[model samples]
Target: MTHFAPVEPDTATGESADLLTQVKKSLGAVPNMTKGMANSPTLLKSFLALSGAVGSGTLPAAVRERLAISTAQLNGCEYCLSAHTMIGANVAKIDGEELDGARRGESSDAHIAAVLQLSNTIAENAGDVDEADIETALEAGVTEEEIGEVVANLALNVMTNYFNVLARTENEFPVVSL
Candidate 1:
C-alpha cells in the first residue's frame, strides 16, 4: 500500500483535523480516495476546490454523471466505477434502468446519450475525440465549454482511479452493482 492512512487521519490539533471533519461531515464518512488526498492537505483542498468548481459549472448534473461513468468505464477503474455509480444514482437522482444502463455503459437520455458517446469515444481512442463527435455533442445542448468540462472530469477521474489502484484505498462500502 502507499501508506495512505497517515494522511487520512493526522494526529494534529488544528487545520488537518478540521479538514478531515469537514469531509466526514459532508460525506458522513471519509472515503479512501479523499483520505489519500488528505496525504497532502493541499491536494485535498485543491480537489475539493476543483470538485466545487466543476460542480458549479452549468453542465447538467446528469450529463456530467453520464460522462464521468463513461470515462471511468474506459479507464477500467473499478474504484472509480464504484465511486461514480452512487453519484449517478443517488446524487444525480437518475434511477432504475437509467442507473443500470449507465453501469451497463448505456446512455439513459438523449442528450446524455450523446455526451456518453463522445466521452466513450474519447476514452476509447486515447483522447483523440473525432471532430464530428464534437459537432454532435454541441447539437445535443452541450456547449463547447461543457465539452471541455467533460474532458476535465474524465482526466480528473483517471488520476483518482489510478491512485486508488496504487494506494489500494479502502473501499468504504460494498455496493454489488459497482
Candidate 2:
C-alpha cells in the first residue's frame, strides 16, 4: 500500500497545483509519482527542473532512458521501474531485450556498455567512483560532456528512486518485471 497518497491535481494548491498543471500539459497525464511529489512543492519543482534539464541534455533519449532503467533497478524502485519501462518502450523506443539489458546495466553497444557500467559504479559508490572507473568510461569514448550528463541523469534518477521508496508511490504505469 502507498504510504503517502498522491495529491490529486484538482485539490493541489500554490506551486504544487501549477506544477501539476504543467506536468499534465507536457506529458498529457500526471504520473502518480509526480502527484505524490506534489505533496512537497520543493521536491516537485526540483524534480521537474532537473528532469527537464537532463531530458534536454546531450545524451540521446534512448541512452538517458536506459540509464534511468539501470538506476531504478539498482535502487530496486518498482515505481520507477514500471514507469520507465513504459516510457522507454513508448517514448524512447527501446526494445524488450535492450530494456532488460539496461536493468542489468548491460548493453550490446560497447560505448553504451561503458556508460551503463559507469552509471552502476556511480550509484553503487554514491558518486565516490575512483580514477580507474573514470578511465574505463573515458577509454570507451564517453566524452567529458557525456560524463557530465550521465552524472546529472544519475542524480536525477536517484532522487526519483528514493522518493518512490519513501512514498511507496503507487505504480501507475504498466508494471514490468524487474
Per TM-score, the best of the predicted structures is 2
Candidate 1 on 78-136: residue-level lDDT in tens?
A: 67777777777777887757756665557647777776777677767888877888888
Q: Once model 2 is optimally superposed onto the true structure by TM-score, how far is the C-alpha of residue 174 displaced, in angstroms?
A: 1.7
lDDT of 1: 0.70
Clash counts for all predictions: 0, 0
State every prediction's TM-score relative to the real structure.
0.81, 0.96
Q: Give the Cα-based TM-score of candidate 1 against the true structure.
A: 0.81
Q: Residues 1-178, candidate 2: write the lDDT tens digits.
A: 8877888999988888999999999889998999999988999999999999998988999999899999999998988888888889998999999999999999999999999999999889878999999999999999989999999999899999999999888887888756
Measured with C-alpha atoms, the lDDT of residue 29 in candidate 1 is 80
Model 2 residue runs over 4 Å out of place are none
Candidate 1 Cα misplacement greater than 4 A, ranges = 1-3, 6-15, 176-178
